[model samples]
Every structure is written in structure tokens, then in C-alpha cells.
Target: MKLTHWWPTALNPISNVAFLRPIDGGMKLAMLFQLAIAASAFSLHAIAAARPNIVLIYVDDLGFGDVSCNGAKAISTPNVDRLAARGLRFTDGHCTSATCTPSRYGMLTGEYPWRKKGTGVLPGDAGLIIEPGRATLASILQQSGYRTGVIGKWHLGLGDGTLNWNGKIAPGPLEIGFDECFLIPATGDRVPCVYVENHHVFGLDPNDPIQVDYKNPVGTEPTGREHPELLKMKLTHGHDFTIVNGISRIGYMSGGKSARWVDEDMADVITHRAVDFMERNQAQPFFLYFAYHDIHVPRVPHARFAGKSGMGPRGDAILEMDWCTGQVLDALERLQLTEKTLVIFTSDNGPVLDDGYVDDAVEKLGSHQPSGPYKGGKYSLYEGGTRVPFLVSWPGRIRAGESSALVCQIDFLASLGALTGTDLSQIKTAGDSQNVLPALLGESQIGRQELVEQGGGNQLALRSGNWKFLPAFAPKNAPAKARPLELFDLNQDPGETTNLASQYPERVNEMRQRLEQIQKNP
Candidate 1:
């Protein structure tokens, strides 16, 4: 038997006088016991060393086909491709929702955002959606002796309803278990265009108090609606409000001009900040949630990557995102943490061209399929909307390969909890997260047997094995078109072109009922 195991059994008779006496093999027994104790300590140290430093690279609005590894020829994601080459690349991975806010909420909380009201997209100055003491992904890891930090776009909202941008912001990432945080209060296209490091604005001047208003105009700045000449990028839709760095955002902002971040310099700024976090926490196991704000609305690449991609600003932004990924990977290598780190790359949702501004995303598109073989993109209840790029890499540990495992970001809570040896049974708030660590690490081909996909307007679809079902429902405030239930055998129709609702009525009914039950209970 192993010395570590045998030592514990032999330790039962420690108090016995006969066992302690230096007679016969008693001296040899003492030496063996000392050796066994040393062996046990070494075994424990090895186990602790095995717990890797996790770096989750969550990208925004990046499609499955945007990376070269996923079949994109227009733009190359060498850094993301490098990750796929080193570890398992999931072919059928997904986010919980089609939109950014809900998907992010689902990913962190491990609970379906649709089940909880007020989890939708928030304004620039909305309150904290996540309750302060709830069990979250970061909190779980934090409890497992991991130093947790988040840097980048934190659209999950901050503070209570009455948030003071100039003062300390409470009920934020710090309150929810993150030891460190450097975040954008909302999306880049939103107002209050400043960075929030921990609690206060990064470079806010006390004299220049910040004021933000979404309803009525607050600042005397030129808006996209009034001054079209001031805009460096033109708007195609409703992103016409106060101008902050030659671009009008969704809301109005008055002060904190010194703290305002330049749109072109955002990637560089955040990339450096992320590297610094890793450097500071390299001595121990750290969980860095590096969310990237790239290839999203107002696609403004830095001057270095301005015209790199011939496909315009959107493609250029993709290249920029790839560079950011490279920066993080290079940092890991520099810090000698490559093999000791577990990195996961994925997107919040699918991609959408012309989300708000017109940056030639559609015009310069020359035979580039953003969603690859999927049907829809962004806000629709189709395969393309929620299916995103999911790549995981842990050098020397996770074998390099491809997996068709049916996995979702919602499972990160339980899967990672299992990885860190946290007692998941004690975490009652992990609503729908399942421990899919084996699947995530490429040890198993199967993941979740069924997954729930959410699109815009709280529309949902169900996926069971190779079959997908979409229930019939009329959209709000729209003309009530006679829409029928839809079903597809995904193995045959991955693009979701054929609607087999008429032929398979019984299966549709069963799936619809199952979906309803999940919604009601989950």
C-alpha cells in the first residue's frame, strides 16, 4: 500500500506503550512512520501545486467564425488559434443568452438570467444587479484560496440606484468577492466614459464632479444628432447623445474630463492593466476574469492596428482583439506561469454587424461568414446567436485536441468549483451549473445532455442531444404573425433551415413541455 495511506492506519495505536517501546521492530517502525509523514507532506504539496491559476478571457461580440481556427479567412486570430493548438477547442460550446448583459449575468451567477427579472441590459448608471453576498464564480474561487481579479468591460452594472461616480462605489465587484477590479462602468458606446478602478473613477478630479443623465441632456457637449461634423465615426442608429472623444454615446455626461478614456487607446490601456494584475498575483493561484471590449459597437482600432485588416474597422478591431490576447499569453510566458495557468477564451454572444455605428462592417464584407454555418446572429433564437468560440488551454496538463462536447458558460461555476476542490454541495445558489470538469478538460465527449438558449426578448430554445426545439410565441408590440412551433435535428440541419414542426408534432409538444417545466422550476 502507499506510505501515505498506510501511515494513517498505523497512527491509530500511537498512545499504546508497547508500540512506542524500542523493542524488536519498534525503532524501524518509528523510522518508517517518519518517512511516511514526509511522503504525505510531499503529496499534499503536489496536490496544491496542481491547482492552476485560471485566466478566463471573455470577449464581447466575437462570432464563432471570426477566428481563423474557426474558419474565418478574412481575419486571423493567431493568439486564440495558439490557445486552440495547445488545448481542447469546443465545437458546440455556447453562452447562456444571445445578448451581452444576460449572457454575462448567466456566466457569473451560474443561473439563467431570464429566471431573474432586472437582469437585462443596464444603462450607464444602473445599480448593481448581483446581490452582494450571493455565491458567484469569483466568490467560489476566492474561497478556494485563489486571488481573484477582473479587468475590462464590466457591463454588469455598479453601486446601488444612486451611484456617485466621483465617490466610492459600493456593492460592486469588490463587494462580490473580487480582490481587485479595473473596469469600464458600461460599454464603450455608453456615457460616463471613464474607467472605474476598484471603487472610484481612475483619474477623476475632485473639482470636476461627474454628472450623467440618460433621459434628458445634461452636458453642453455636441451630440451626434445636432453636430454631425464633430463625429469621427457616423451613427447608423440610436447612439446619438452627448459626445465624448469625437463619438456620441447613449447618454449625457458633464464632468470628469480628465478621467475620460480615449476610444482608440482603450485596448492598450486595459491590456496593460490585465498584465499588471497577473504580474502582481503571480506568486499564488489567481483567477483573472479578463473581459475584452473588442469588435463591438463603435469599432475604433488604435493607430497601430487602424488599417491592418482590409475589411474595415470591424475587422481591424478583430485584429486588435487578437493582439490583446497575445499580450496576455506573452505575459504568462514572461512570468513563467504558462504551464501553471489555465486559460479559457470565449465570447459573451454571437456577432452583429452595424450594432450601432456604420464602420463598413457590411459594405466591406467580402465573402466572410461571421456566424460560419449557423443561421442567425446576435439577437435571434438561432444557432448562431448563442453558439460562440470556446477555447481552453492548460499547458502540459490538458491534452491538445478538439471536443464536440455540449457545454455552456453557465457550467463554469460548478466545473471550476470542482477543479478547485470546493465543496459544491454547500453552494445552494448554483442554480443550473453542473460540474462538467471532465468534459471541459477533454476527458469526456459528453457535457450537458440538454442546454437552454436565450435570445432577445426572453425568447428561448432547447437543445437535447442532436435535436433542437423552438416554442411558438408572439413577440411583444409586434404584429401577431401566426408563428408555429419549430424543431430540427441539429445533426442534419445545423443551420436550422428546415422547420419540422408539422411532421414531428409529438416531439415538439414533449420538448415544449420540458422547456416550460424548466422555466417554471429553474
Candidate 2:
């Protein structure tokens, strides 16, 4: 039970309720006794034998074309690229959902986010998405004796349906599985724009109470919709609420000025917290989910990386993320935990420039293709929306190779569970997850036989072997049109430019029937 705030000097501090004493001559002995007991209990709960450390580096809105390792030439990502060179690069890896909140739910629970109602895109004040009694990846990993911690983004709701910014919010990340947590309440562009460590909001000023609303403004905070002159980045759509760091966000907010995070230092802050958490738990097998808030909206890069990218704020933020990766890697090497640790790098969804801000992601584009020849961007049913750069590195443990295996990010929980000798007996929805450990290690080039995909736009596609089947459904968020039933041989045309529906009616009907069967189960 080690817990502490952003204290770099002290490093890992033991978390105990006994530290509440004012003056105690026998506190040291009591503390030591408690520590020993906790160690024993934690160890007993964990699996026998030493399990390899797990680190899942999740990035925000990073597309297949964002990383140098994934056919990206315009930007530099030496650290991520080098890691890809050391292990397996999964070209066909995908998140369950094409949006943030849903993808996170699927990734953590191994269940489709759509199964939970209204989990498409969560507002900051939304309640905890996962039920309180559910079994999460963090919970399972904790049972397997891993010290779990989550740093950065936590879009999965917190507290009950009603969250009070001033009061204590219970049953959050710590209750779910993470032994320790430092997180952004929801997003950099959302309301209650502050950080939370454990159960309390960090650096909250008592005199100045916090306030937030999405439907109606509090009439106190500056907004981009009415006060355009106060903003640095202009708005395009939904993100025209309260302004912070000269950028307007999605919802309204006020108070907690001192506690508000600096937009430019967001990357460094999250990276440092992750590195620090790893350093603290290096002695034990640990699971650190370092979710980076990069390449998302309000793309504010630090001064050093501000103009490094010619493609505008989106590209600039990516460079900053690359730098953060380098920093995390450097820390891992410095602590000598690289070989013993497992690193899985991936993105929540694909890319979308000009999502809401006027960061020049659309206007400044020259020859850069964010989706890499793919049809659609974020919030679409096209391959580019969910397909992203998925890489796993374990130094000498995993072989270095590029695999076109059809593995989903949701499979990681089961795959890693197998690595730690865990049986999914305690986990209820183990039905959705498949163990692909061999595929992840590059020992098997082939992966799942049939994988389903969700475009955040509400379109569904199924991939079985080399063929992809998309039934007759018009594209959402676009004009009405009767789309023909489609089936394409992906092996022949990876770009999915041509629809072979009319040519292969039999295959389309076969796949459509199979999809009905899979969807019917559970």
C-alpha cells in the first residue's frame, strides 16, 4: 500500500491509515507491522511465480498514419518506432469502438462499450461507466499480484450519476482496480477541468468552489461562442464552451483557477507521473496504464515543440507525444526495468483534425494524409476510424517482426491474463475476450478468425479472414443514400476502395448470417 502525490524527491510512500496519528512513540513499529501484513496479503492474492511487468501506453486520437512506425513519414517518433523495431507491430489491430469513452470501456472490461447504454462520448460530469461490482482488467491484474496504477485520462465516468466537484467522490479508479491513480477528470476539453489524485481533487481552493454545466453556462466563465476575441484557437463546432489556456472546450466551467492544469505541460506532467509510478513499483510486478492526452482537441504543444510540425497544432502535439515517449523510455532504461517490463502501445481511436478547434489541422494540410489512404477519419465506419498503431515490446521475450494479425485491443486482457497464469473464472464477461498471447509474441502470424468493428458513427462491419462484410446501411452523419450490401477481399485491396457486394452476393449473405449468430451470443 504505497501512496503519495507528485513528490519527486520522496518517490514511493507507503499508504496506510495508521499515519493519521499526531504523536506516537510506537508508530514506527506499528507501521512496519501493518506494512508486513499488507505485503503478505497482496502477495497471497497475486499468482505464484514472478510475472513479467505490464505497461499499457494508451494514446489519444492517434491514427494509423500518426506514428513513424506506421507508415508516417512527416513526423518523427523515434522512441515509438524503436520499440516497434524491438517487438511486434500489429498492422490490423483495432479498438472495439471508434470513439474514446466506448473504446475505454471495451478495453478495460473486454465488453463492447455499446452494450452499456449511452456510452458513446461521456461528458466530464457523467457517472462511472462500469458498474461498481464488475470485474475490470485492473481488478484481475490486482488479484494476480500486480501493483496497478492509472495515470492521465479517465473518460470512464466517476461516482454516481450526479458527481459533486466539491465533495468526495467514492468508488472511482481506486475502487475499480488501480491501487493508485492520478487522472484528468475527463478530458482537457471538458468541464471540471482539474486533476484528481485518489479520491480528492488536487490543489482545490476552499474559498473558490468549482462549478460546471453543459446545457447552460454558469454565466461566470469566459466562452468562445460569444467572446471570440478571448480565444487563441477559434471554434468549428461543439467545443465552444468555457475557455481555458486560450482554447475553448466542450463544456462550461468556473472556479478552481489555481488547480487548473497548464495545457502545454500536460504531456510532461502525465509522463513524469507514469515514470514515477513505475520507479516506485519496480521491485514488484506492476501494471501501469499510462494514458497520454496527446493529438486530441485543444492541441497545445509546449514551446519547444510548438512549430516543429508544419501540419499545424495536431502535428505539433504529436511531436510532443513522441518526446514524452522518449522520456518514459529513458526513465525505464535508467531504472533498468526495460527487459523485465512488457510495453503495449496503442491508440483509443483514429485521427480527426479540426474536430472543434481552428488549429489549422485542415487548412494547413499539404501532403499529409492523417488516415493513410483510408476512406474516413474519426467517427466513421471506414477502416481508418478504428484501425490504429498497435505495438507490443518485451525486449528479449517478444520477437521483433511486423504482423498483419487481426487482433483487437480488447483481446489484450485475456492474452496478458494467460501470461500471468490467470483463469477468467472470476471475470463474468470473459466471453468477449480471446487469448492471443502467441500472436502477440509474434510466434503466430494469424489471429482471430472473425473480428467485429464499430465505427463511432454507429456503423458496424465484420472481418472474417481476408473478407470484410458491411451490410446495407447508409453512412451516419452523412446525407441519406441507399448503400448496396458489400463484401471486399481485403487481401486484394487493403484500401477498401472497391465494394464487391454485387460480384459476391453469396459471400456477403454468408457473412451477414454469421454476424447474426455472433451478435446473438451473450
Candidate 3:
């Protein structure tokens, strides 16, 4: 019946004879046609199976306007700019939450961080937040035959609550499906400041075992509050607990001296590890979540990048971050994996000038707006908090252009899950993560129809189209005032200055209902 199918098996001998004789031209043509069809099908299937290498460059505390491509005139992120120039730059891209822990949780697990307890910013010694056996981005990709590795800031907690630093750290990135992990278990500013490689602290001497305690001082380590003279970088607030590397941290540690990571050399060290990962795994498809440590608190750049940005440590850190990004880009190019890799550059949350360290961010700002034209920064329920710079580059696959599609980091699970042919329906806890792969590829202008934005605690806001609605909630530390429901069209008021809650009560009510629905269901 089907010439393409039957010709190969049944008429093979006859077709060959016909070709040999050069008489039965019709048979030769049919055979040729069948072969061409078979080859085309095989080629298509091969192309479909060849999944591209994925590199998620998750930056810490970077803002929307921090890169030059996104309107930062004061500072230039050339690597990030080159990425934008070659791929899709999303203007309305957002993370699930405005804070680090929640955003990372959402990114890895494909579930809202608010749904889980203890998803808040964890200390260095806190237990793993992601439950064991949970389906994660790394896990999903690993299932599809990709080598998953996470390098750099891993603020996601490690091990059980009674975690012994000297012993094997379980239930970490390895347990969560990552094959390889070299990480800062928590934030750079936090303590027990040692690099955790795979399961144990890197370079930890067994003779001088490591000990960590967040509640109390462990040994004779000088503290910033007690000994301000020892601090090279002065603390402005809560970071005056324990001194490590001449800088005060939030927690205390005694004897991980051999394993401690220098603040300035973090970028270089992590970049080397990441590039090494790429080089080693170049033969196979890999998922490398190379999170940057620069541009975070206690902004200590290498001597090369020192004073490069006039905006003090903050600006210098941005430059350092850009350099780190360039290194990865260079590695990808060197390995000839640029066209075969999908590199996504985005931040965990928004920006903050004076987040516990006195790095002169406020006084030396010099008219550089980190959060762009949006109101609020890291901790608020405004656009600036969640709406961050998002760039996705896949060389020839994703066309270079700007897209206003409202995408979120939370959706990566579903989007990539769909991309790699994973069954999203089987993923039990993919909360609020929709597959907008087409939008990510710059094929579609529309992204999520509605998205939920989270603040510090249980506070929430709904973003539908260009309109944003925040339910009535009183300010925490502000003066006594009844802050009513607020709504603003982002297209009209990008600064979020005017509250149109009174004008559109019905719309607010609808969005509020939608928010409640998502939260309750999720």
C-alpha cells in the first residue's frame, strides 16, 4: 500500500535489478523516493534527539538596569550585552519571589517557594529545603541523559538539621539530582565560609576538622562587633557576628581555616570550576547552573576590577560579574559548544545598595539606577524586586531580538521539561510553572497570562497583562496608616507611582481572586 514502507522490504531485489538494467525507470524513481523519505525521517529524529547543552548563569542580587543592554548607562555588562545582542532579551522577566532563597527554590523545584515552610533565606547550617526525591530541574534534565552540575552560590540548604560539617553532608545538591556540585552552601556574607565540593568541605584538613555554630561563637575568631579594627570591610548592621577573612559574617565558625574561601577570589575560583565542568562534559549534553557570587554583599572584587566602576564596591562587583560571565562565554566558544548550548543569564532577585555591608554603595552611587525605572528593590512587592534582567541565547536557534513577553524563572521547569520531552503531568509539584518555551525561543510574543509576585512574608501581588494589583496590607515598619489595595498599569506607570485601586475595583477583585486561587491550589 505505502510505497516508502513496502518498497524497502518486499521490492528490494526487483528495485536493484531495475536500477542495474536501467530500463524500469519508474521502479528506480520509486526506490529513490523511498530512500529519500527514510533519510529525511532519520535526520529529523536525530535532530530531535540531539538536545542542546543548557547553562543557566544565575547571578546574585543583580537588577534589571544593572546591564548596559537593559539601560544601565553608568555600568556596562559587555558579555551580557553580547548575549542579548545574539538572543532573546525579555523586558518583563521575573523570578518567583523577590528574595534569594525563595527564587532559587522556585527555579530548581518548579514549585512556588511560598508553598514550602522554611523556604526563607537560610543560614549556612540550615537543613535542605527541597525534600528528598522531589522532581527538580536538574533531576529532569539528568533523566534526559544530561550531566547536571551546579557551581557557585548554592544558598539552598544542605543536609539534615543536625548536619556535622566534619562528616559527609547528605541531602544536598547530589541528593537533589545534580551529579556534581561545588558550592558555597549559603550566602557569601554568611559563615562556615567554606567550599563544599560534592559532599565534604574542599581542602578541609582531617587533623584540624571544621566546626560551625550559628547561635554562638565557636573559637577565638574575632568578631566585627567586638573587634571592629580587624574588619577590612566594615559592617553596617546584622553582619557583625563572626569575623572570617577579615570580614564579619552572620554566623560563627572555628576551624575551617584550610577550607575557607577568600571573598575576592570567589569569582575566579567558581569560574574555573564551571569552565572545567564545561570542558570535561563537552562530549555529552550537560546542564550547568553556574551561579555567580559577585555583586552580592561584601562586594569584594579582584584587584584587576578594583575601582573599575566609579560606583564603589557595588559597581566593581558588577564589572567582576561581567568578567566572570565573559569567562564562561569564552569557555563555551573555546570548546566549540556555543551553537549547541542554551545559555540563560538572569538574577536571583533584584538589587540592594546597602544590604548589611558598608561598601559605600549609597554615597558613591553617582546616579546609577540599579533597579531601572521600577519602584522598590530586593524586598518589596514592586516590579523591581522580581522583574530582573533575563537573557536567553542559543546561537542560531534563538533569534537575536527583544521580547516583552512576561516570563518568569519559575516556569523554567515546565518550559525546559517540555523542551527535553519530559512529561510535566508526572511532576506532582510543578506549581505555577507553565511551559513558555516558544516565548523563550523568541517565537512567541506572549508569555504567562498572569503571574503571582511574592514579597518577604505571606504578602503577594498579581500581575495580569500590564496591570499589577497588590492587596491591602499595612506597612511593617512604616508609620500608622491604612494602606489600601493598590493597582497600577505597568505600561502607564513603570515607576509604580500612582495607585489606581479606587478606579478599577472590579478588576482588582478579579485579580485578587485569581491570586487566592493560585496560592490555595498551588
Q: Which candidate is the best by lDDT?
A: 1
lDDT of 2 by residue, 1-522 (tens): 433322111101111112232333365656775686577445423422548889999999998888888887777788899889988998889888788988888899888665567777888988888876677888888988999999999999888877777778766998888899999978888977789888988889978888888788885878888799999888878788888888888888898887889899988888889999988998999999999889888898998989889878889998888888888788889989888888999999988887877788988777777777666767877788888889999897778989988888877777777677776755667467776665777866756777778876456788898899987775566647446677878888878889898888788889999888877774
Misplaced by over 4 Å in model 1 are 1-49, 480-483
Q: Better model by lDDT, 2 or 3? A: 3
| Candidate 3 local distance difference test against the native | 0.86
Every model's Cα RMSD, please?
A: 9.5, 13.9, 10.0
- TM-score winner between 1 and 2, please give it: 1
- Scored against the true structure, residue 392 in model 1 reaches a CA lDDT of 91
lDDT of 3 at 487: 97
lDDT of 1 by residue, 100-204 (tens): 999989899989899888888889899999999999999989999999999999998898988888889887999888999999888999988999999889999
TM-score of each: 0.90, 0.89, 0.90
Kindly provide the TM-score of model 1 when superposed on the true structure, using C-alpha atoms: 0.90
Error of 3 at 290 (Å): 0.5
